[model samples]
Target: MSLALVLDLFGTFFFAVSGSLLAARRQFDIVGSLFLGSVAGLGGGVIRDLVLGQVPSAFDRPVYLIPPLAAALVVFFLLGSVERFRRLLLVFDAGGLALFCITGTVKALEAGMNPAASALLGVTTAVGGGLLRDVVANREPQLFNRRDLYAVPAMLGAGLVTVLWHAGMFGTAAALGVAAVVFGLRVLSLHYGWHIPRAAGTWHGSRRE
Candidate 1:
């Protein structure tokens, strides 16, 4: 019923869809799709909750389970149609990234975490699921991809949420605004091939190898 819960559910759905899409692309069966979807939807929150010494909502609250299951079912049944949009996975991932960063930061703050720790947890919440999904799927995680700007956008969003909360300006409008900014940045990064620079010698070393 709360806005935060609504945003969390939506984020879970988006991430789950991305996971299912990846599974479909890789020719994974329904069971695999469901597994990946659940991981991508709830893994981040689980990590965060564990770190905070709390039970993960995904397990404690049954409502948190619906989105991943729904997403897996939808993608499993409509793989053909969904495959036409090659970028849908990235788009949904971006949506999840945006929403999770905000909600994660808010929750951390609510749990009495400092601003710095909360922002870091927010970044974790945004990218943890995708990282696990990719690792389990035997693919490269975007967090380490040189040409992909994944964690930067998440950090920005989380930092903004932290700043706004500190300023006592965080609310529905601010949360939505922050999410929009993060989502737009993520999409643009995907579109324009924006990326954070690697270590000074890493690229050159790879070239020599």
Candidate 2:
């Protein structure tokens, strides 16, 4: 398999794990966990592929379905052990975000998209899955959370990928380096409570009857 395929699969697994953990925490049934895991693993890629006018890999390729199922089973069976690690879901999410940004940009570039557009799509791919997972689980999306640094890190990683591709310096090592940097930035943001500034003052509307 190609390095790009490997990266895509790894991202899928990471995101699926995060989704599965969330489902476990929510006390979802195994079927529900699997469903959420699949959505989280494949949603972004599906969106990306659709935007590119291609069939979604999760449907076109059977291999793409394995990661989410495996993740669901793992989380369901290992709930206790997995729960011992604090913020484990966020860690996995960071890993997925880092890799998807790179792969998404690369795919868009390969499809003849301009660097600017490709970078934007990369950010979309990085965040789409988590956003869907949150909505499906009936939780607020981290992307819209004022105090979260989710999309910014994705944008940074996507921009870097675009730059490297334009410079003709994109390779396995460069890809890994960019992923590592993105992951570190996300983890650090979580640890330090970093976020972009929001509009000053909260909105207060008239109280509802």
Candidate 3:
């Protein structure tokens, strides 16, 4: 398969796994798990495609559905053992994020979008599914709250891809390199508790509801 397709599949699997884990944690039934996993796998790509004014690849292809369903099945059968797979999930998710971010930016650029708009589309592609998953699961989205270094990494990855593309370095290898760098930085951030601070005083007078 092409590198772009590979990246897309990888992203789908991890996002699906993340959603499946959440469903299992919430004690959702099999149907719920499948629905959640499928949504997580396709949600971002659908949004990305729509923003680009194209038909969603997820809807046009069957491979897009199979991986997430397979992942959900595995998670469902091994629910009690899911904790042992946490680190694995994080690694996959980070890699997927990097890949999706790069691909999103590249796709946007191909569609003649401006750099800023392309970068935003990339971030949306990377996090849209997770955001949807969180909403469906009735939990706060990590991108909106302090949890993990999520969107920042995607932004960096997309930004790098955009810069490289502008610099005439749009080869597949260059894109993969940018993705790797972003993924590495994200993993490091997670290990080191790196974070972007929220605006101070934005909630100065507010208390948790």
Candidate 4:
């Protein structure tokens, strides 16, 4: 497989695992876990492909879903056993975010998108599924929170990928470096509780003022 394909698969697996864990924590049915896992793995890619006017890869590439379904099944069977590894699941999610950011940016560039739009799409690819996952689980989307420092790292990684592409340095090595930067930023933010401050007043307050 090409390096991009490999990164796509890895990101799918990592995101699937994260979603599966959430399903397990929520005491969802096995089918629910699998559904969430599949969505988490494929949703962003579907959006990206659709926006670029391409067929969604998941439709033509059934094999791409195997890892996600398998991951859900594994988590389902070991639901209780895996509960102790919450930290590991968070790390895996970060890996998924990083990988998806890099791959999404690369794919958009390859499709001739400008850098700014490509970077935004990369953030979408990084966080889109998690947004859906949160909504389906009846929680607020994390992206709506000012305290969630997730998308910034994705933008940074995506920007790096776009820069590399322009510099003719885009390849497996540079991609990996960008992914690592995103992952590192995510992990550090999680560890240190880093976030920008929310705006001080509500929208209504400003209008009244």
Top TM-score model: 1
Most lDDT-accurate candidate:
1
Candidate 3 lDDT over residue span 1-209, tens digit each = 87788888888888888788878878898889889887887898999999988999988988888878987888877767657765655665676687789778878988999999999999999988888998999988877766478999898888888898899977888977888888898789878888776655445875443
In angstroms, give how far residue 172 of model 1 lies from its true place. 0.9
> lDDT per residue, candidate 2, 96-169, as tens digits?
99999999999999999999999999999999999999999998997888767999989999999999999999
Collision count for each candidate, in order: 0, 0, 0, 0
lDDT per residue as tens, model 1, 103-141: 899999999999999999999999999999999999999
Instruction: Single out the weakest 10-residue window by summed lDDT for candidate 4.
Output: 200-209
Error of 3 at 111 (Å): 1.2
Where is model 1 more than 4 Å wrong at Cα? 201-209
lDDT of 3: 0.83
Candidate 4 to native Cα RMSD, angstroms: 2.9
- In angstroms, how far off is 146's CA in candidate 4? 2.8
In terms of TM-score, how similar is model 3 to the real structure? 0.88
TM-score of each: 0.96, 0.95, 0.88, 0.91
TM match of model 4 to true structure: 0.91
lDDT of each: 0.93, 0.92, 0.83, 0.83
